[model samples]
Target: MNLDLLKRTRMYKGYNQYQMAEGIGLTRQTYNYKENGKSSFNSDELLRITTFLDLSFKEVNEIFFDNLISK
Candidate 1:
C-alpha cells in the first residue's frame, strides 16, 4: 500500500491515528497496522476510510490501486 499520501492528508486534517481510526469505526491498533502496510484493507474498511477521509474515487485509486493500474 502506498500510504504516503494518506499520511500527509491525515496530518493536514489534524487527525491523529486514533482519531482517524475511530472516525472510520476501527481500533487504533488495526488502523496502525493497516497504515503501516502490515495488513491490506478489506472492501468495507476501504469504504469506511474513504468516507472518513472524504476521498474521491480517483484519489482512492491513486493511493491504493497504483499497483493494479501498473499491471
Candidate 2:
C-alpha cells in the first residue's frame, strides 16, 4: 500500500497523522488507515490529501497510479 511513502511524507512535512487528517477533512482513524495502508483512499480523499500536502497533481498521480498499475 506504500504506507511508508505516506508516513514518511507526512513526517517530512512535520505534521502528525491527526493534523494531516484534519487538513484533508478525514477522521483520524480513516486517515490512519490510509497512511498505514490498512485501507484504500477514495478519489476525493486522495485529491484532498495531495492538495492539503501541497503536492503537485502529477506527483501524487504518479505515486498512486504506479501503485495501482503494479498491483
Candidate 3:
C-alpha cells in the first residue's frame, strides 16, 4: 500500500485508523502496520478501503497502484 497516500487521503476525509480498520474488517494494529507500509494489503483489503473511501478509478490507481495515470 502507498502509506503516504493512505494517510493523506484518510485524514483528508476525516477517517481515523480505528474507523478505517473496522470498515475494512481488520484489527487496528494490522491496519496500522499495513497503512505504515509494513504489511501488504491484499485485493480484498484494497477493495474494502476503496469502497469505504469512495475512491474513483483514477484515485484508486493513484493511491493503490501509484500509477497516477490521467483519467
Candidate 4:
C-alpha cells in the first residue's frame, strides 16, 4: 500500500483519522494501525474508504495497489 499517498489524500480531503475510522465502521486505534501499516485493511474497509474519500478509480489504484503494480 502507498501509505504516504493514502494519508496525504485523506488529509487533503479534510478528513482526520477519527473521522476515517468512524466512516469505515472501525475504531480509531484499528484505523491507526491500518494506516500505520501495523495492520491491513479488509476489502470492505477499502470499499468504504474509497466511497468516503470520493476517490476515483485511478486514485484508489495508486493508493491501494501501487505496490502490486510495481511488482
Question: Best by lDDT, which number?
Answer: 4
Q: Distance from true position, residue 1, model 4, in Å? A: 1.1
Give residue 12's error in model 1 in angstroms: 1.6
**lDDT, candidate 1, 1-71, per-residue tens:** 57888888787878999999999898999999989888887989888888888887677877778646642
lDDT of 2 by residue, 24-50 (tens): 898899888877778899889878878
Give candidate 3's error at residue 20 in angstroms.
0.5
TM-score of each: 0.82, 0.78, 0.89, 0.91
How far residue 30's Cα lies from its native spot in candidate 4, in Å, is 0.4
- The best candidate by TM-score is 4
Compared with the true structure, the alpha-carbon lDDT of candidate 3 equals 0.89
lDDT of 3 at 61: 87
The sequence of per-residue lDDT tens digits that candidate 3 reaches over residues 11-51 is 99999999999988999999999999888999999999999
Evaluated against the true structure, the overall lDDT of model 1 is 0.83
Q: Which ten residues in a row have the lowest lDDT in candidate 1?
A: 62-71
Q: Model 3: clashing residue pairs?
A: none
Task: Give the per-residue lDDT digits (tens) of candidate 4, residues 5-55.
Answer: 999999999999999999989999999999999999999999999999999
Best-first order by lDDT: 4, 3, 1, 2
